[model samples]
Target: MVGEFCPRLVDYIVLVGSHSTNRTSSSIQTPVILNRFPPTDHEDFVLPPDVALFCQPEGCFNVVGSRPARANSDSSTPVRMPISFVFTLTDKESNKVRYGVCLNFLRPIPRRPEGRKHSTSSVPAVGEMPRRTSDVEFSQLPLPRNSDRRQEDTGLHEKKTQRARSSVRLRTHTLTSLCLITHHPFFTKFRALVEFLHTLIHKLHERSRSKRSDRETVWGVLAGGIPSTTSSLVTRSVQEIEIWMLRLLSAPAPVPGKTCIHLAVQPKALMKPLIFALPDKSRLPLVDFPLHLPIQLLGISRTLRILVCLLLEQK
Candidate 1:
């Protein structure tokens, strides 16, 4: 029976569709080689070097384009076949593009059991019944019909619950590890921003000492005049941060929940030192400005606000 139902490999040849993502204005044209049917051997073919042909057994004359149904199976249900098609396309610039599509229909074959073989006892004589361990007949033995079935069902349910819990634990661990990897880039950029902000604050103090008549405070000067040395660096770092936040926002929820919240909270916590470093803050007269503000320096306030809102909404 197994030999009768054993699977067989088949091959086919068909044209596959191809599409280009380039935005060239000129239209594609057919190559001169394809104009002739069955071009000569000397002519170049469009097949790519990377593509390989499928290998099949020798002496097999049959070419099955469609899956064949089993002899005893119902005709209504037809088995799907593993078939593939290959085609080539040429653009107006004479560049060849090869396309291949394949349907995966390979199924795993069941392996036979292998172990030590045991010798079977000889059958009893024709008229004699088989040797019995007890007087009770097999059919007459006690059978807990409903109770046994209930026990079996309970066992199956417990096993399923355990498997589900283990799977969830595995997923959570994976998420945590990936979140750490994602956090590294954000942390590096944050450190750079912090260092630059500190330097800018110190530079503002130096400028205040040099120019006695310039009564503008450090915060006021920052609000009005951009620093020459760290302006581009600050802008690039802010852009990087915004990009990281956007990526974290777009990532799969629940998996990235902890990472997102950590990102939102850490920024507020670290900005405190930068705010304290600002000299003459009391005389700045900037009522609208926040004392402990990292966004003023980074310029990613709007993006950060949107990110926080999105994260909260997701929660």
Candidate 2:
């Protein structure tokens, strides 16, 4: 009877094994069939992973083997795969070890416009680029020294001095011409003497007339002695004219080498004849006496001519 009981127990174990296998096979087959199922007009299907495993407790287990070999697939075909890494965290409350795999699948960052990059490493540092050839040449060039600038200034000064000398020579020539005209022989001999007398007489008459009119009472006594009065007036007039003439002749001309007489003689000569030709009373005051008048006029002419020449030279 004990032997019979053992056989029955073995039979029961076998029966359970067969039922378990059938159930596992059915479950696995269902997924495969569904993956292989044809797509409907409105629906698409996706295949499941070749291997999958679940962990229910803290333990070590091999979840998958190496990837299956691909058959006749292009080597260059891009593959999409999930990358995983183990992470361990300790549970504080239970003091238990927890394990997880981080599926941090890496993806290439999308290129920006013209493939620009934001990260610092892709760009050059402050001084990494090649230096320009032009810049190197400019740095090697020598600076302009002070001696070059000094030579330019020296040349400019020489040009200025030459201009100044030319102007001085021209002015000297002009002055010489004016002096020659004044001292011409015809002007000096005849015309100059006449002008001198005319100027002298005019000045004397003017002085005498002023004195007589201003001192009428003093002249009233002298008026009765006509001869004495005339003589006295004439004498004074002649003396004053002579003094004025001498002064005019002696006055210096403005240009260094030229004399007053040389400069003024011509103009004075021209003026004398005009004065002498006037009616007696209208003539220059003391010209009625012709004795020294001509010589005196000559002196006056020389003086006036000198003044005019000086004035022209200045202009």
Candidate 3:
């Protein structure tokens, strides 16, 4: 009997082992033994009639086997076992622990295409375009080509030259006129006669005013061609008159043929005796006088006679 039971027990252990490994691969398993047919006190006896079996996953298991099952055994209830399996597998080669495998069971991925290349003749080179010359000959072109502008400049220059020449001619004519007027012989003689007359009139007027009463008394004597008393003042006055008369008569007359004396004869006769009264040595004559008359009168009388002779010669 024991031999037959051992074979059955061995078969049951094999089945449980296979089932546990298979279930562990997919999930986990828990097995529990209960005291029923195999009681602890009757280990050498036959298998107990009150034994129980409990099976669960690897968590929350319990054992229950009391007496036997009259109708129901309290120990025959399913045991609950609390079991936990924490798998900590370490990989030494790549230093990575993998829990499960991820399978990519689809087609292979595609790669990106390579870039295309271009030929050199597809684009134009920088030196291929035609270029315009920046340097040009501007000086060779005809200058502004306006005949009116050239003529206007030439006419303006000629007008300025003519005005300068006309101004010079006008200045030359004015200078020539001034020279002709200043050097005229008639004008020279006329100016000299006027100056002489002015001097003679001034002297006569001064003498007349100084001797007004005496001149009034001597007016008859002078007209009658007679001599008065020989006073020194009368003599001096007469001398000044004589000198002025000679200056007037000596100047050249404007008329050619007649001398200044012939032209002025009446004026000479009227002034001669009045001038003779002065005792001037320049008026005295070279001829001898008769001794019967006073020396002063004779001297004066001779001077008048000499003046008349000179006048006749001049005429």
> Which candidate's lDDT is highest?
1
- Please state the error at residue 131 of candidate 2 in Å: 99
Ranked by lDDT, top first: 1, 2, 3
Which stretches of candidate 2 lie above 4 Å from their native place? 1-184, 188-193, 210-236, 244-315
The digit string of per-residue lDDT tens for model 3 on 1-315 reads: 001111010001000111121211322224322111111322222321111111122222222222112323343322221111111122455343211101101111111223445666546566786554354655555566478788989999998997665533321000000000110122223233333433443355446536654333222122222256354544555456445444443433222222122223226756431111112234542222234334444577776776688989853
Worst 10 residues of 1 by lDDT: 172-181
Residue 49 of model 1, lDDT score:
23
| Model 3 worst lDDT run, 10 consecutive residues | 172-181
- Superior by TM-score: candidate 1 or candidate 2: 1
**C-alpha local distance difference test of each model:** 0.30, 0.30, 0.29
* lDDT, candidate 1, 1-315, per-residue tens: 001110111011111111221212123322111111111221333333222221111111111112333535543322332322222233335443322322212111112223435647666777998887565687688777898999999999998997665533321000000011111112333333333433444454445534532233342222223233234334444344435434433433122112222223135656532210111323432122243344644568865875688989953
For candidate 2, write residues 154-179 as lDDT tens digits.
88888788665543322200000000
What is the C-alpha local distance difference test score of candidate 2? 0.30
Alpha carbon lDDT at 104, candidate 1 = 19
Give the runs in model 1 whose Cα sits over 4 Å from its true position. Answer: 1-46, 52-130, 133-315
